[model samples]
Target: MSDEDLRLSADRVLARLVGDPTDSARLREDQWRAIEALVAERRRALVVQRTGWGKSAVYFVATALLRERGSGPTVIVSPLLALMRNQVDAAARAGIRARTINSANTEEWDTIQAEVAAGEVDVLLVSPERLNNPDFRDQVLPQLAAATGLLVVDEAHCISDWGHDFRPDYRRLRTMLADLPQGVPVLATTATANARVTADVAEQLGTGEGTGRALVLRGPLDRESLRLGVLPLPDAAHRLAWLADHLDELPGSGIIYTLTVAAAEEVTAFLRQRGHTVASYTGKTENADRQQAEEDLLANRVKALVATSALGMGFDKPDLGFVVHLGSPSSPIAYYQQVGRAGRGVEHAEVLLLPGREDEAIWRYFASLAFPPEEQVRRTLDVLAASDRPVSLPALEPQVELRRSRLEIMLKVLDVDGAVRRVRGGWTATGQPWAYDAERYAWVARQRETEQQAMREYATTADCRMEFLRRQLDDEKAAPCGRCDNCAGVRFTTEVSAASLDAARGELGRPGVEVEPRRMWPTGLPAVGVDLKGRIPADEQAAPGRALGRLSDIGWGNRLRPLLAPQSPDAPVPDDVAGAVVTVLADWAKGPGGWASGAPDAPDRPVGVVTIASRTRPQLIGSLGERIATVGRLPLLGSVAYHDGEIDTRVPRTNSAQRLRALHGALTVPPPLAAALAEAGGPVLLVDDLADTGWTLAVASRLLRRSGAAGVFPLVLAVQG
Candidate 1:
């Protein structure tokens, strides 16, 4: 690792670039100087170049220099598939013997590996996720290690937790390169990196103190060809409407970003409905669909694309004339990356954001979901630690016992938190378990919060939007671009007041109405009879006399019976009896399982009953109760409850049985629903009567919690005791 040994005197590396006849692109003087310095210094170097500054050219130049001097093959590790593809394509266009390894070419990866090993491949582009493969590391990497070559890491900022787009897998690359010879140099390049990120990249690459060099090339972040605009939209719908109105004005190649898949679908649907051809991309999208959509956009078959942040990184659609964020992003880095997609071909472009009052709230939710609470971190770590080998999503789901949706969100959160690392096929723990600092987590959380706040300010402030962005990038002395929303003739207006924004509200609750018993009357009887006959509306049956008579005749306690009961004229129930009913309801609300709820002898048996309150034969409730009983039979069963009618059937019906039947028809279990619930880290039982309205017993346990059900084992059945 001496200075003399580190120097890139290898002329063959330089020849690899300049020797290629197709490499017509020339490096700028500053880029050349940086390249010369890296070659002479022979140490790990950080090259921070501006967008379109041809940072790739410097690497190519150095590669040419090394090739001329008979250096070994060069390997470039990239985080983006599209970026890797683009780099490989560029090298091929330059007549360099370059090959790439990514998810798209599994069958060819082994051949590519052999080629690299035999020294037939000069440059190799791969993703960090691919490095975890035992075959790649054990068989393929050793060959690359033996060759006299350089390792180039692209988008190196991903190594830093503080970096806008942090990737935990990037941290493992240091160990991956540990076996390389001491004299071999490593070069890292990025378009954007603050001092903190720079230091992090160097440290993660194991470029020890004074052994690494950083070059921060100054360039204008300002793009005069790009017109910045901000619109104050009340919601996503309005933003879509605005886009529709301006669709004709927008260029054919452009991108529209939404915060979520639902939003992306909605906007894409709205645009297509209005006669604009659009493609969409999101995590839920199938691989084929994603590729088709991307291809459609790239081929100009689709005039525009509505996507989430998934569209960034590797996408190289340089002809894009505009980039519009349906809402504000969680960070300035995200905003810059998204906006950078535009004007890449040196043509005029436009970037717009429809800022709303809830933008900050929306961004905060995304951030929080991305960086979950400490408990979640512990859970993820535990799950990873328990695994004997790397496991895919399907294999891990049952072990963690969480719903797929919930687990996926938590995984993404853990990824952003840097507590866990996801490789190509599986995940593993990263750093020390205690390495997750609360202060750093809080800072990132606050930074996300601040970016959202800044969006609000940008939308409402009289100053230029471009200037605000520049200041965010640490160019505080930069002047206004004089071409943004504020620079134009637009006037600032505050539609929402500070008080309204600051007002605290309850967290999002479950999405349905709760069903409570009509009267407060406790039944001393051990058995209750259920009537499956007529529609019993909550308001119509809220009478004390009717409820008491039914309770008195049903013999309510432990046994269940089904029978039709006519309305009876009875006196009002006593206050003491009513108070007893309240106590029972409270107990039901508290549910049957918890640390305070004493352990039962028969742990696998149902602990409580759920009676569905309906006038007709409580078939829906009966069927649901049976399912709950089955769930209670689970080894770890804690509680059980059933609803009498199809609580989920949103339709109103006068005939109870028909309504119940209809409800059953509507309650089909979603495929991913069971997986998601299992991942929630609990065992649950769902109950209902007749399984009618079909919704009550089908993933009802999970839905209840989602809808803000305060207690577990809440039941719905068609009987009264």
Candidate 2:
């Protein structure tokens, strides 16, 4: 078709996409250019436009035109389930039959795949993670790639490790891109890539060596409707209180982003108590709850959805009037993408940043989960190479020191690098030569540090906040956005009501997070030389326990994180923390299921106290044990001793299997401690500075129980969520 004829057809499709046949919703010139490239030129393209710039329109219109010409379905690789849902609904409005095959709708996979095979589906939306699934990658992906007419990679920044939100699964797209049929058109798009990331993604899209390189369509990253501001508060309490006091004063219902899931729940609860309608959305939220939360927010049924990054990327609500961050994101690029959720189809929207002292701690925690070192990566490859059959992740965990999540990520990256391949049963070594990219990994780490420093500057910069963020993304047209608080004079108040502040403090100040005991042993413990498997014996199991606070909590967490940090000095518990521990114990004793609750199921009161022998924080643990024993008038039974007085430092930060293996014969109930336990005659309080993975607590509790203690009640200063 001629350009003029294509433009006329695309215009009508655009009107249908907007749900108004009578509305003259013609595609913008850039959007038209993109469609023209994909349909007329049959060329690859990268559209780096700002959010709500109608990137989706280019693809939807292209899909309609392609299907009209009897081309195969358009397969879009989206990053989030929320994004896929919005696109599916939007496609329906354009009279295109859209279907999705994601983790959430596994039951419909067969039907959806059949429909696509039969050419009954015009668009198929898939998640990036699906690209690496064993069955999907080996069985479905090739077929889809061969037949796909127009391939769209949404949020393409994820394909580059330099991108703020890189995922290993996204990089797997290279193989699919390289294998595409000749003349097949591909389009990659994102709103948060700087020059480096854009170049990297474009290079990946150029895998078809003989084909012309991807056309790059870059635009300015500025949101005129967003009125940016920063409200620096005293602490988490004040920041949360400010939200409670002034949330209604903000434009329309919108998101309030938190740095952690604990904070999300905390904020949602406090906001609801303050008479605001709110819901929490986090990675841990069930798919049904997430879908419901999105619906409620889109329909304005709830004032806001207190969310984490789980709600970011591709949640489409054009009239969203505000985007507030309770704590600043670690990168300014990330911050821009999140705030871009607001003011898409409206004249005005509020974007406020309430930076907290705890932001750095949260950032550091996430940073720690980055790709493992060269040694660990090599070890994983060696293990997989030695395996005769495909080894499942659980079976592989004992041999690898990395945690499950981290290990999965490493395997995905290796799979993409051709060192390993995920197979029917599990993963297998491909016997391919794989060299560790130490320099590249180091560069990425340094880039992360630089981004973190830039985020710090963003929070305190006196210049235009939008310009600062735009420049972070290498936007050449970045200038002072006159709508920001700094550019337009401060627009939001830092003041909050005394009652709301107190309520927030009280809510956050309340201590005690439940620490559930480990009920089952880590899989493949025997492979690590530990004689353990299946369910932990009931008699050996520790009862549900309590910690003073979560390290991720907004209130007590802020106080406990420093005290429990790995580098923190081994000092005795501070008075304020001790006092909070006492308050928690008192509340626990009188609350349901407590020893002093007077309920039928409540356990007998503690008769003694025992401490976990800490290799690093002996002073803290020893003093805490004595303090608790003295306060309860109970005997201070000696600590659980390390075997032969030797410590296993490797047990502190490892996966469950490795930790348990190192701990299997590493801890013992010495005769003195056992005798003391026998004399105590009843349950003893187990004291530790922190509980992570719960393996240490379980081992120590079992030692005490077998040594004649009636029961174990574990207590800790902090818990890792």
Candidate 3:
């Protein structure tokens, strides 16, 4: 075709994509170059462009062009569900039929597969994890690979370990790439990758034997519209108060990012209490609820969605007015990726960071869950090889000494490396020898440390914030953008009113969070000699309890952090904290989700108090129980003693099964306590300083039930969620 003809076809696609042929939506020259390389030359290409720079348009146009020329459907491998949804909707505007196959809509997978095979689907969006799903990988992936016209890896930086949000499932893309037919084009796109990640992903794009030279089109990693600033708050309460005061001042509906799910929920609740319309989006959020929250934010039905990183990378609202962070992310790359959500389609979007003292602590907590030692990986392989059967994740949890989340992460990495294979029932050893790369993981961890330091610098730097961030991403053209606080002077203020501050202090200082009892026993307990399985009997289970606060909550969490933090010396419950506990008790008696707030009927109030013996914080636990007993005028029943002193429950910090093993027969009800409980003939308030895994509480509750306590009402200073 002639150049004019090509330009006309492109413009027509762009118009369709934008849902307006006369909007004059034209592609940038770089975008056209990416499309031409993918469509005409059928070469591998990587596009490292800023957000809202028409990266999606390049792929959509390439798909249209490839389809017009009778190539098979484009398969887009994306990392997030929100992104998949956004892509589907965006594709529809361009008259491109897009179907997604993700975990949320498993029932529609068959239909989506049929549509793709029948040539009715223009763009097929699938999560990277789908590549490892037994049914999808075995039954559908092969056919999809053979028929795929163009393969697009969205957020392709995730394919590299150097990427801040690296996902192991993305590594499976290499197998798909190798399976594709000759001369098929492949495109990888990311806005967050530094030079190292880009080079690594580019190598993956070069994996196809018949694929020719790869084209790398990298643009300046700078957003002129974002005005970045950092407000260094003294504590979580002040940070939250600032938000409550200034949320109305932010231009449009946007996201409020928190570091943890609990933080997200807590912030959402606090914001709503402050009379702002908002919702929470985190990994724990139900898929349907998450979809609704995304819609609510997109439609401006809510002022903001208080969210964790779960809301990052795929929810699109071109006119997002602002982005705020409650805590600093561990790295500048990840931080930039999140703040990029703002000022995408609109000019002059406000981006603010309220960095807290707790930010580094949260960062350290995440750092601890990184890749495990080589021995643990070997142990996992040994167990899987010895099993001679596919061992599900739950079953594997008992045999492997790793925490569930970290273990699953390891298993996924192993699966991608061909060291293990996920099958019908679960995962099995692949009999492929794999050497653990200690140096790589160590390097990644070190990189994380460096990035964290950089984030600290980014927060306090006198230089331009955007320039600092761009430099962190290794942008060669990095220069002061003169738009951030350092360049333009403090743009967002930290000022908050006394009334607002008082409200925040009251909210944060007011202790007591609902401590949900564990309903079901973890599976595979029998393997660990615990003999427990299925649901815990209601008669033996601890009732829904109360805690002074969550360890992740911005309010009480800040106060509790120092007191309950690791290496902190244990002593009697401090006077102010004990007073807070008194406040918590007073509120718990009438609190919405607390013990006395039962819906069908008013729940039984504690008639007696019983302390759980603590090895680490005996004084704290003992004093807390005495205070509750003294304040409530209830009998202080003698404590539950450690019958088997051989085991330390928190030593390994293992999974549920192992935790149960540690707690099995570990507690003994004192004879006097047992007598007091029988005499009281009512619910007993069980006190402890911290509830980490709830197994200790579970074990204690079981003993209390066996010893004839009418009900076990477990209470704690902090509940780790």
lDDT value, candidate 3, whole model? 0.87
Candidate 2's TM-score: 0.99
Lowest lDDT 10-residue stretch of candidate 1 = 504-513
For residues 1-721, what per-residue lDDT tens digits would candidate 2 score against the true structure?
7889999999999999998758688888899999999998889999999999999999999999988998899999998999999999999999999999898999999999999999999999999989988889989999998999999999999999999999999988999999999988999999999999999999899888566888999999998899999888999889888998999898888999999999999899999999999999999999999999999999999989999999889899999999999998998889999999999999999999998888899999999998899989999988988989999999999888889999999899999899999888899999989999989989999999999999889888999989999999999999999888888999877898999999999999998988899999998988878888999898888988999999988898899888888788888888888888888788888999999999998999999889988789899999988988888888898999898888877673658888887788889998999988888788989999888889999999988889898889899999987
Q: How accurate is candidate 2 locally (lDDT)?
A: 0.91
- Per-residue lDDT of model 1, residues 682-701, tens digit only: 32334333222222332243
Provide the lowest-lDDT 10-residue window in model 3.
644-653
Clashing pairs in 2: none
Best by TM-score: 2
* lDDT (tens digit, per residue) of candidate 3 on 553-624: 777777788899879998989998899888878887776645567666666777899988877888888888
Better of 2 and 3 by TM-score: 2
Q: How close is candidate 3 to the true structure, as a TM-score?
A: 0.96
On lDDT, the leading prediction is: 2
Please report the TM-score between candidate 1 and the true structure: 0.63
After superposing candidate 3 on the true structure, give the runs of residues whose Cα lies further than 4 Å from its correct spot. 2-4, 591-605, 647-651, 670-672
Q: Which parts of model 1 have CA positions greater than 4 angstroms off?
A: 1-25, 146-148, 206-210, 370-436, 488-721
TM-score of each: 0.63, 0.99, 0.96
